[model samples]
Target chain A: MFLLPWFLGLVFITLGPVLVSLYLSFTRYNILKPPRWIGLDNYVELFIWDPQFWAAVRVTFFFVGWSVPLVLVMSLGIAVLLNRGLSFLPVYRSIFYIPSLIGGSVAIGLLWREVFGSSGIVNQFLQGFGIATRSWVATPETAPWTLVSLNVWTFGAAMVIFLAALRQIPTSLYEAASIDGASAWTRFRRITLPLLTPVIFFNLILQVIHSFQAFTQSFIVSNGTGGPAESTLLYTLYLYQRAFVQLDMGYASAMAWVLLIVIAVFTGLLFWSARFWVYYGDG
Target chain B: MGLAVLVSAMMAGTMVPPAAAQDLSGEIRFSWWGSTVRNAKAESIISMFEKANPGVKVSREPGEWGSYWDKLTVQSASGNQPCAITMQSRWLAQYADPSILQPLDDKVASGELDVTGIDSAVLDSGRGSDGNLYFIPHGVFYFTLFMNKTAIEDAGMELPPDDWTWDDYAQYARDLSDKLPEGSYAVGNQGGAMDTFTDWVQSHGETLFTPEGEVGFTKQTVVDYFDFWEALRKDGVTETADQMAEIPDNIIDDTLLANGKILIDARPANQVDGHQKVLDAAMPGQELVIHSYPVGPSGTGEDIGSNGLAIGATCDENGTKLTEAWINFFTENPDAAATYSSDNGVVSVDRFRTAQLENPDTTPGQYQAVNMLSTVGPRAKSAYFPSGGYSALSGALTSAYETVAFEQSSSADAADKLIAQVKRLVRD
Candidate 1:
């Protein structure tokens, strides 16, 4: 009896729409009328007929393939630098962490546009060094890189997590290594990296998932049309365009399900590979 | 006997009373797309309406242009759209069905909605493909070329002649480009602008879409249109593709044209006043001028559209009456028209158009826009956008142009791709 509200909320708010969307994936639903079932048609069209779908896939894969690794490396590097005993560590950590909190927001997306724009601060700084530059966010070849840089800029969240895990590492191990006259680089290579593998694996899976779902940055940067020859057409942004702008809810639903399955497969692979590299202190 | 007397008086148009007598009591939801200035104007006009009809209450739901349609679509899907919806003629076919929007023809035939003084051609622009008038057009809009007059004068070049053709337009830009200040272009790149392309197509004696809702213009026309802009870009008469990509066309504050980074660009005729204001603030002493699109082989193939109001299907009888009354008040009421100041487009009614033109208080930019519309309205052909046609064409045009601009595809290849994408998207 006490769980009625929670149960009702779960059923109505969460599961209901999910199931409805599953049904809608196979139907012709434009939201204004009752959905008409047309089995496998949306999927068939998405795979064979739609050119934008392929473009979306290419853009999303590029974003995920680059951004996830860059973000992980940046966060780990900064975390290592800050993990050493430093003054005002909390302040530095806070400053570094703020970007992650607001990075996915519309305001940040807009700020990123202005900052990478032709006459923006980056260009102004480059111009001071006598380097001419075009608008980084506008060029089809370089536009996706701006978004990659934005994702890397928000490495603060992972950095904080890494910092926490670094603190949890036993000081005795380092002391023993010092007594054995192990070099700093050797200590880091043999001890620190292996000990941090679990956390690295965690951050990797989380970031991979996060990067796959990215939308706002691409949407805001491209002005919602994913222009400049659809260079920044993220998968989720295309889904949004199909569902909202084109009013093709059924196709969007199919696209959503495809994305879900892709994420699932990728996650499954990550887990299967984790046994080989991820350390849990069991050995 | 009293009821009979009231009915007879109402039918005879003799016993006219305020909203209370006409039974116009109840609140109706009204939604529109605009900026803060337009929102304030709409609010004041709505308040004036509420005052004149004391028993009526209007709930305002203003939204920005980009997200307004998305929100409305969601609301419509959930069956909660506002009683009164501000619709554009280009988007009318998408929601014209009786399930989404109420056909206003019945209201007009019943004398409940007054479209008096509005041009019949403009009224027809609001009709869906089914011949049902889904909306009442309050403003008629067309495209025009906005020039930085100060920049042209500074470059020691005269504005293109009134009878300038596409070639002459390009030549003028090229001539001006050589003399303009550093870092400024002769024009903002408009190879992707759908309306400009429409003008180009129409001038070649072709329509953008057939009456049967198929792609009307040939791929060769598309190729020629692209080549026109490509030639200018190659000659440094326009901004770089990347710079053009950076600036959004809708936002006046950041537009290259308004910021004095470009000598000329195509913009909606009604936006002259807004653009002038931005230019005034952004680059003081820079004067803005409005000119019709350059003539083509056929003539000025200008296409006109409209911003108008429609009633949602879910509106109750009382809500419908209130919506009809609001529409009538907006259209027939001179004060409302004057307050609106033709923010969206030129006033559709003849009297209001004339009044605004004659009013000394009207800014010169606005006056020029209205006068330009008057001159072009007779010759301007209204394009009938099929369901999903506008959005599809807009996206495809931008994508196709970008591919050409970035050297990824030739103009001919891009045009072929554009036609294919449009065919798929529009009919999907």
Candidate 2:
């Protein structure tokens, strides 16, 4: 009974837009006019000739490749540290989680620009340390990495989930491993590693999807143009440009569907790989 | 008996007055994008209008420029478009559908909307692709390059003449940068800007697009333009490629020009007021002077454009009537015009434009804008921007220019890339 609203919302909100976007992918639509059925023209145009589309794909791929693993490892490591019954545990959790609370907003994106900007705080500190500093966000080659750092910094949510998973692992198992003459690394590898696979799998899939859809950080950093030579043109930002700025809804829809398929394939591959490594508590 | 007949006829005819057209009573939904200042002026005008003409209400829907079009496009398609839709030249065609904005020709003919104080060319410029007046511009924005007079004097360099060539502009910048404080630039970068490119190519006797919807300029044009900017960068005249990328579109804010870090800037004449204010705050008495775009190498001309109000398709008779009244009041009234202070570009009404400049309260930017408009006469020509083509072309222009700006591609290669990209878009 409780799931009824969610199911309704899925159909009306999530699934509805998805279906419409899929259909629109095959049409020629500009927002001002009625959509004309063009039958895959949009997709053909995007794949065959749209240089920006290809650029966006590369940018998105680059972001995901770096941000996901960085976020996962950092979150897991922080979670492990917090799991150690340290004094003032709650305070530390709140302090660390603050960055995540403001994650991926335009405000944070603007903040990231300042933090990584030319003559910004980072440069001040670097110059103080007798190191030469260059504008990180303004430079095309380093702009995306600034965004990646921002994404990695906001790892508190994943950290919290990992912490919860850590607490659930049987304390008896760790005690038993200790009695069995196992070292810290050995016990962690034998018992904790296998037990945490499911959570790791969950976090990986979630982070990958989130990282793929990243837009705001890049959009804000690049001043909505994906500038300094299209170096920071995240896929969603490009789609948004096509959809709203250029008024090419059909092309944007095609881009959207392509992204959806790519994410779906990755998630499917993750699930397929899951049986080989993810250990269930029941087993 | 004759006198009585005449008196009866006169009484029946309402000869003294046309029986004050029923006080235009209705709610008009006015939408626009602006800064806080524009919004405040518009709202105050709205209230004054409502009070003077009882029973009328104006539902204001103001926003920032960045998201204005997104909201307008959605509202237009969704049938929720406000009765009064604000229109900018670049985005005008995107929303100027017969099904979106009612052609104002009929309104103008019937005297429901007045255009007497506006020049016919300005009125005609608002015409849709169908050559019908679907939009009515209240103001005009002439794109002109500005010279920070103080910066030039500080650099001990004289200002370039209005008819200075592109080469002269660059040489002047180099001279300034050589003497100015370190990190201070001689000119602002215009590598990826379509507007600046338009000015360049126009001077070269080719526009980005011809009247018949063909790409007017050649690949060589793009190469030469890229090379011109590259020369500036190489000579340390303009902002570094990295610093160039950090500009926040609006010229009035925390920019090198405001801070007196750059002497020459390409900005709309309308932005002068805000630019002057910021300049005063940053480095008082350093005024911005408007200069004509460097006569293109080909010696062609510059582009003229404006922002205006368009009546939406969904507006009912009463809503449109109220909108017409409100638009007229805002345009023709000296008080309203003075309050706006050429903020929405130079006031389109002749009387208002003259009145604004003549007012002592007017900012230096407004004064410079009016001066530039009068000075750049006949040399300014507004181009036709087809909806999707303009935005896509702008994006492509950015990509091509970025290649050269970032040192990732040669000027020739970047030009070829730009030409091919524009061709693809125009063909589509």
- What are the iRMS values of all candidates? 1.6, 1.9
What is candidate 1's lDDT per residue for B1-428, written digit by digit as tens? 99998899777674353343576789999999988999999999999989878889999999988789888888998899999999999988778889999988887888888888888889999999889999999998899899888879988988777888988888888888999777799987889999899899998899988877899999999999899999999888899888778888988888888888887999988777778888888889999999878899999889999999999999999899889889988887888999998988899999998999889999988898999887789889898788778988988999999999988999999999999888877753
Per-residue lDDT tens digits for candidate 1, residues A1-283, read 9999999999999999999999999998877778999999999989998888999999999999999999998998999899889999999999999999999999999999999999889999999999979999899999999989999999999999999999999999999999999999998888888999999999999999999999999999888978778999999999998888778888899999999999999999999999999889999
Candidates in order have lDDT scores of 0.90, 0.81
Q: Write the per-residue lDDT of candidate 2 for residues B31-121, one digit (tens) a residue.
A: 9899898899898887777776777888989999878888888898899999887887766767667888898887789877777678776
lDDT at position B294, candidate 2: 80
Q: Estimate each model's TM-score.
A: 0.95, 0.93
Clashing residue pairs found in predicted model 2: B272-B365
Can you list each candidate's DockQ? Answer: 0.67, 0.61
Q: Cα RMSD for candidate 2?
A: 3.4
Give the per-residue lDDT digits (tens) of candidate 2, residues A8-117.
Answer: 99999999998998888888788778888999788888888878778888888999999999999999899888888999999999888999889778899888888888
